[model samples]
Target: MTTKRIIPCLDMTEGKVVKGIQFVSFRDAGDPVQLAKQYSDNEADELVFLDITATVKNRPILLNVVAKTAKEVNIPFSVGGGIRSVSDMQLILRAGADKVSVNTGAVTNPALITECANAFGSQCVVLSLDAKKVAPNRWNAFINGGTLDSGLSAVDWAKEAVRRGAGEILLTSIDMDGTKKGFNLELTRTVSRAVSVPVIASGGAGSMQDFADVFQTGEADAALAASLFHFGDLSIPELKRYLSEQNISIRRDV
Candidate 1:
């Protein structure tokens, strides 16, 4: 069985990691570079650094911060936000990122996904979808840091992105974001089944069972959380151990 990945996300702004409920009411968590090292040292399978406000600000990704954080961790690092073109992705990759995730930029220009995959291989292009449930078993993919709806069905977009050469899908439930209730299992499972690529489930992680549930029931390839790991509510090591006990195949070498 493939070992399920446990990833800690760094939602960043002004060069600092921050967290909020449902993507608002933000508060500082810690320095991105410092936290990157800590999570990498503590056995996180991967680190995702998202410049949450970069698109809204109409700026490029913070390459300086990405470089600093990348240097601190040996694990695979994925950076997202404000990446509008292949050139931007090259800049980020040159800065030490293993992969580049595109959200708003990809929505506006679906061809960008193909361009990125062609330039850097599909494995290096991740489609980051911020999905909000609009009805039962229905979701709309949002962009601009979950501030704008792209009028695209989240599941449909996932399939289209993968067909266009996105190697992975980073699916986050805006409704469940920071709620700590649990992951949006239905939404996750739907997308996971729709896509042929690995799907990383994000949002609503509050406990260890949440991780197990997402993997076992939701069928997510990976589980990602911010404040749960950022606020020390749970440790990656502890969660991995718990998942192992639950018979979830996880990377114990971390």
Candidate 2:
């Protein structure tokens, strides 16, 4: 079995790392490059830098920070937000991002996903989804940094995204964002089963048990958390140690 991954998400706004609950009332976290280097030097399996407001602000991703952070980490790093075209993906990849995640832009024009995957190869295209539970076991995809509901079925979109050549899914639970309760296991499992590509579960990670639950019960390939890691509530190595004790094979050497 492939070892489950533990990733640290760096939600950035205005070139500064920030974290917010349910995607609002944001607070400063730290510098993106510093956090990237910190997670890289630690045991984090991967790092994700999401320009959370880039799309809403109509600005490009912070490439300068991405370049600096990319130099700090040896592990895979993904950059997202304000990525609307194939050229944007190319620029980010050239700026040192191993993968480019598209959310609002892809929802506005899904062909962008195909174009990016075709040009950069499927491995470099990541579909970042912000979903909220509109009904029981049913989620609606959100856009514009989780402010607008796209009226797209989250599960259906995941399948279609993979069919369109998206290599991975970054599934974030809008209801669970920074909730610290636990992941939306039903949503994660539904999307994971709907797509062959790996699903990275985002939001609602509180404790070590939350991570274990998402991986086992949710059958998630990876669990992503920002506030927990950013606030020093838990460290990647400590989380991996806990996962190891639970018999969930994870990369501890990183």
> TM-scores of all models?
0.93, 0.93
lDDT of each: 0.88, 0.88
Cα error of candidate 1 at position 60, Å: 7.6
Local lDDT at 235 for model 1 = 82
Clashing pairs for predicted structure model 1, backbone only: none
Residues 1-117, candidate 2: write the lDDT tens digits.
789999999888888887742322233236778778778888888899888777535344488888887887899999998888888888789989999999988999999999998
Residue lDDT tens for model 1, 185-235? 999999999989999999999999999999999999999998887777788
lDDT of 2: 0.88
Off by over 4 Å in 1: 20-29, 55-61
lDDT of the structure predicted as candidate 1: 0.88
